[model samples]
Target chain A: MTRLEDMVGAAVRDLADSAPNAHDLASVARVRGRRIRRRRQALLGAAAVVLAGAVITPYAVLDGWNGGPRPQPVASVPPSTAPVVPVPSTVATAPAIRKDWWAAPVRLPGDLVVTSVGRREVNGPNGVTAVAPKTVQEGNVALDRSTGRYRAFSGGYQGFDGAPAGRYVMTDDGITAQIGILDSVTGQTRQLGHGSGRGVEWSADGKTLLLSLLRGGVRLIDAKTGAAVDREMPDAIALCPSYCNFTWLPGGEEIAIAQRDPRVERSEALPDTVRDIRVFSVATGKPLRTLPVPGVPAGSAAWSPDGRYVALLPDAAEEDGIRIAEVATGRIVATLPLVEQVRFIADDQILTVRGLDVGVYDLTGKLRQSSRLPQDFLGRGISLGRA
Target chain B: MKQSLEDEFTAFVADRGQSLLRIAHALTGDRESAQDLVQGALAKAYARWPRIHGDAEAYVRKIIYNDRASAWRRPGRRNEVTVAEVPDRAAAGRHDQDVTDRIAVREALLSLPERQRAVLVMRYLEDRSVEETAEVLGCRPGTVASQASRALNKLRLLVGDRPVSMGGAR
Candidate 1:
């Protein structure tokens, strides 16, 4: 045995022996899968915002490289140990939908038809105050390849003094303990306040904002007129995080909110905290729909475009896929195969993350096509232009 | 095929997670960073489970090497490498661990760059060949040869010992 071999063997063998299950790859995979899915969805949403910004921001539309060159994959790339090779000068496309999926940048129609609202828009900059395990963080924003869109993965809100204030999407940027609003038009930040530091979410229409006051419970405010729709949106269940999480329905007058009940028995699939999913009127704050709690805790609820069904992603516990339920009757219409994250592309089609690949699945849950993204695709750097 | 995706994944995690973490810890020289590196690689590997299941271990090992290789290129990351403390043979849970030799090896290995460190680990510790190491690292065989030669030469200089080369090594 060579001395080098002995040394390496000694080190590796010791490591293998002393190693503990510090973290599980399976669980880590599931978590990362969800993170990747979120990033993809954020990229998609940010692209739309950039598309919208193209109308408003002059420099945005003029950028030729944004979607000018058509991406075509080469047969093979020469091997290199370097992390970054020049952007290939030519974009690589996947071979086929099933064999190798590719998201090519095309001239997306100027008129975007959005069936559902998923993540907060990639509007630039924001602040957040997380109540649990209490800490403050400043937010940072990464602009999409398209113009005027940004994802505040971290860093805090900007542009408070002389900035236009429509309604900005806010998350917790704990450092400042200040809630910041990111302007949709210009990538600028403005402070809302330091106390109760979480960012308030905006309604789909951009008319309403969800606020969690440090003094008390949650409050819903009318953004345009600046009036409280409800000082206390009746957190009767107290199932909210530092802020509250609600799935906005089609009409925008109602939202499905989480109601916590410890007595509610749950399977390994459900988030342990959730006991029920309820829909309440934005106008009256009254229960409109009380979903039958599956033996599992359903966390993220996506109401279908036509208002026929609601898709529920169980709170992060297991890879128990999404559940599609009838809105009126609250019956589980269909169950999907295990997926890490899900989003709605068109009304009839849903996008899912199946490992590193993204699959387009129909309402019936049959996969229509799968696409392989560029190896380095992430929320901050990548966007797909649809034809 | 014998187990569900989750089951199989769980088995890999339970059975192989520790060893992978140790390798990562050795590479990173810190517990937190090692956990991060190993988990990140596992997550990437986990996503392709359906296609790569047959060679999952190798697939994951490739990711670890690549991730570490890539990290070396980043500006601020290289300074994080530490020559780990001298291991007490007793602390290593074995009577055979030669503290003097192991510390010498650790120092020599830490003295090299990340890519060299990765190449050396594969070639010497794991018993991989020039071609296999190149294949795993997505580099040319010539590149692997030069990297291995340089790393071994550095090790010999650092430790003042005859370095054994294993061509049929793996």
Candidate 2:
């Protein structure tokens, strides 16, 4: 036995010796097993009835029909109708690098999600109010860089995703978790659904919000009206009963979700050892295509402004880096070692943060410019975008 | 769910329930969740007991590991939590140092990613061989080695420069 092993063993020694409870676990397990068996039997019976109906209905309709010729069978729809425009792996497609990108003011398509390291004052709702530092730790405000105005959110919002002005998808840290959209302008939050709010993202156009529920599955709702979008999409119960992370594709009409292989679930392999990113249409909740790219968490995925490429912090970065992949082909275009946060500032320029330093990189994975953040605003912060 | 099968399951649970609960406690770091995990695994085993009664413990253990692995990914769980650092202090006695070290290791273990933590538990606490752990996890032996190494490095970071002693690296 090694010293390290001894320490770990000793740590749980008392726990190992604890006595079993007085409850009859065997009886409880039997009851649960009975429920499982009953459910399976019911499902089997339903399946048999469906099979019978399928066979009988086809024969009944064909026997009564007397058409000149049987209508030709409709062709099966292809998995994807999107164009496959593959770029040569050797060529760099990004625009000319701007060496002085960091010198000028940092402009972004969305608000900057920041966690204040110290007390600071900025333009607030009423007037300039002293905002406390580290109020919500993981970030609580959406700072509009142009006007220097900030909208602070309550409910322990992690500030992972936000819209242009001050709207954000946040989950309340209460007994009954309420996933909603918080409009800083009106200081009101309209509940959209119930979830952990940890896996929420806005669509590329910022009109819809995708919320991953704790019970299982994702929900799409209109950002403005708080009304449910994709009314025909599969509900949480029928979609996924296990953990799932979802993000809207370039267009709000579709979404990408992480799904593990069935073999992993059956214990033939390690749990969640392999996962594929599956794309589905938001309207009909039908699978469209499967991206060979590994899946990532919701907020970690960003679609380029042109909607041609997506930058993701994959489950396992090859060299502790982020990957930029062509959306249509799912081919990795570039890999950059930008550890913390990544977002596209323009169609070609990518903004990244590694620790407190920010770097601008092109599509070819070359660092064009780099600069350190201001002393006061420096801390672990996530750079959020409108998408 | 025959009476004979039921009797066999009852006897098995009575014999090994506490041990299973101990493993669950190590995996989840809480007694309530440990009980829930053990009960859930046992119930799953019961659902297929007639076919798996010969190797019931192995089947139940696999369920326990896989269920706990996926449970940690729940958004309501600890996935989004950021722990404040624990300040280190000079120890007054050997007993105090031992207790502090144990607590620190426990915290560090809980903070690891689900797979990495499972690797550590299987390797150190259960004293399982590398190949055995790999088979149970359904991964290549190389992956088990890498995960264990990464997990230990993270533990060292969290526990602050304590000697990890890689003399037992299998």
Instruction: Please report the candidate that would top lDDT against the real structure.
Output: 2
lDDT of each: 0.44, 0.51
Model 2 pairs in collision: A269-B138, A270-B137, A270-B138
Residue B167 in candidate 1 has what lDDT? 33
Residues A139-248 of candidate 2 have per-residue lDDT tens digits of 35544344444544552442223453234434334323345666645657776544434445555444666654332334677778877643222322122212344666
**Can you tell me which runs of candidate 2 are displaced by over 4 Å?**
A11-111, A114-165, A168-200, A204-206, A211-220, A231-246, A251-253, A257-300, A304-387, B1-60, B63-116, B129-132, B139-166
State the DockQ of every prediction. 0.14, 0.22
The parts of candidate 1 lying over 4 Å away from their true place are A1-171, A194-201, A211-217, A221-229, A233-235, A238-244, A260-262, A265-270, A273-275, A293-301, A315-319, A337-341, A353-356, A372-376, A379-387, B1-170
Best-performing candidate as measured by TM-score: 2
Docking class of 1: incorrect
CAPRI-style class, candidate 2: incorrect
